[model samples]
Target: MFCPKCGATIPDSDNKEKSGSKVVKNILLVLLILVLMAVSGLGTAAYMMFHNKSSGATYEGKGYNTPEEAAKAYAEAFANKDINEMLSCCAIESYVDNLDYEAQIERYGAYMPTIFGGPIMTGDDEATRQINIEERKGQLTNFIIRAYLRVSQPIDSPIFSGLALQVGDGKEYDADEVVDMLKGASDIDSIKVGDVEDCYYFLQASSNDNSDKIHKTLKKVYGGKIEWLGVELEIDGEDYVMFVDAIQYDEKWYILAPHGTGASIAGLDVYSGGICELALLD
Candidate 1:
């Protein structure tokens, strides 16, 4: 063979070397294209999976366009005692998603009664049905909070009562009686409570004269176990610290033992405890 550009005679050995080099270069190019295609395919698959998992706030479902809408639909379903519809509005937490639907509801029953008024039961189907009925009432109460939210109502609004219940073991008080108990308590200037869904309560309290008075009052209400109600607000020129209380209770707000007042309720794990978020009404 001869070089076309230079018109120089070329050896067979040189021609063979050049041919071999071209073949190797072609092979390498093909391999690179294949690798790139594979990578692209994997990336596309991952993106599609993520997109499908997160259907966004606009998921296609009846009466649910956003999280708030889903919440309302779920609450309404609970009120109507439609378990299937309530479950439809809910996307299980990933950790608990592996559990079957009935199991999920049963697990939810631990804290379900707090927001959906009913007795917590285990095993028996009859007990489960009765609990479901009670939960409907609990769900209805929480829905009132949602109704307040849709109109931009503040947490301090009397339309929703303030959070002031002792979660001790006892017969539950009616809502009116609970409010009376809170109002009757001493050492607080003003208190306002509201519910954020069926999850938790928002509480705001102003100290009467100074922090000392409020602190003493809390000590009285809670019998010296009042470490959490330490919320304080300054009106004229006093400094106050606020406390967030999370307590568990019955259908009527009877006090549960105040141990696990953590962020259980808002996180939908209220079977452990309920929480009170205290802040200045300003």
Candidate 2:
């Protein structure tokens, strides 16, 4: 039976054979459509994932030819004052010894304003060590006297040799000064020039700026927590360890010179933190 106007389900009037085949075909078609939809969706998802990874700038800017190449490149970037390029190369975390991001960034940024242009130039051919410290000159707008950083210790100590190294265009000390300074340290404090003939000495510091005033500056190198950090430097093409002593100069402690290598001083950066120099690695 069928309803008038509104067609309703009724007993099949046509052949059962035809109805059964049509029903199976329709169901199969629906299943095939579902399968195709699933495959299509999966394919689309995979393609999108790959595309996203490929497109991201962070992923697109790949890195160094090699670790050494990367380091040299970064150094060049730094030397050239290419801030963004250097930062791009700099690791998010360099090492356990490395300063945190804000501190390091601020430190590096400070160099940008002046260093890229040149070290201050002066006609005075004479140099302290190798640094022809052309006075801050016209660059420094605030001529107001900066608080002198010099501080002192209660005890007077014998000062020995000194070695100063100025890397880059600001090359400060010469090989001669460095050699003499190292040799002199032996006579300071102990007055015991060791048996080892022709001993070498190197530039010593915890960090870049805070040299010369080890006792005061050492505290800072350790972030005021530990006592000291050491630097490794090449001297006369030979390398040696150093223990520093500072003297008050102009209300600041200058490296009156260092008190030679202590009796049992370890090599540079052996314990203190830094990107250990090649000498240290060797």
Candidate 3:
């Protein structure tokens, strides 16, 4: 026993006790800080989601959990002519305010031919310009929501019926009236959605040196991380693919509009075709 005690040296029990206590205190301090950070982050995310919903910046209904779910919902909404459901499927309104209004107006103006046959008037004053911008935004929003419905649904569809556009020729016609005038037309009977494909490699392949700029712009507008998905759609026997820019905040996914050069950045040459092409009657 004596030899064993000597070998152990009964070494500094008080010092060992103090050292162990210090280590425990340090571990507890680190854990406390980690807990606080997690709580703060969660609170911020919750606030954003609530604010978006309450302000009408995003759809009030429950957001789709996955990108595929969002794409399918959009297709179903288009086929069913459910404008509210279609709006719920997209996150476009959430980030529309973040875009350059002038650039957006210019970009979307190209689609006016498909929706209306006249120029949207604007004034030179700043206040008038802003008003015009808001009006144009509303018109585009309506067009996007109703364009496909006009093609697929009958003229009796509640949303389209009695809604008429007066063109320059003073002739008033609704979507069905316009679509009927197109030659070699095949109205969309149904829409089928395909699997969602990742757009990372597509971005990497196309961005070249401006990849950093593209990514930074997206992050600034959307969030820290964005998921780009290409959803394939089969509309009335023809195949088409649409790019969906999505962002996840607070564990929920929201689809974003490809504002600015987002479509070009994604290597999408969005020519007038498919829905856009069919919407135009010349």
Per-candidate clashes come to 20, 10, 0
Give the TM-score comparing model 2 with the true structure, all chains together: 0.19
| Alpha-carbon runs more than 4 Å astray in model 1 | 1-119, 149-153, 159-282
lDDT of 3: 0.50
Off-target runs (Cα >4 Å) in candidate 3 are 1-60, 92-186, 200-209, 258-282
Candidate 3 per-residue lDDT, tens place, 9-68, comes to 554778899999999999999999999999999998775654443444444245668766
**Which candidate has the top score in lDDT?**
3
- For candidate 2, lDDT tens digit of each residue in 83-178? 455444432111111223243334445534343112333233324211321122211111111100000110111111123365345576556654
TM-score of candidate 1 on Cα atoms, chains taken together: 0.21
User: For candidate 2, which ten residues in a row score worst on lDDT?
Assistant: 145-154
**What does candidate 3 score on TM?**
0.45
Q: What's the best-to-worst order under TM-score? A: 3, 1, 2
After superposing all C-alphas onto the true structure, candidate 3 shows an RMSD in angstroms of 20.0
lDDT of 3 at 84: 66
Models ranked on lDDT: 3, 1, 2
lDDT of 2: 0.31
Number of the top-ranking candidate, with TM-score as the measure:
3
Candidate 1 lDDT over residue span 78-105, tens digit each: 3344555644443221112121334434
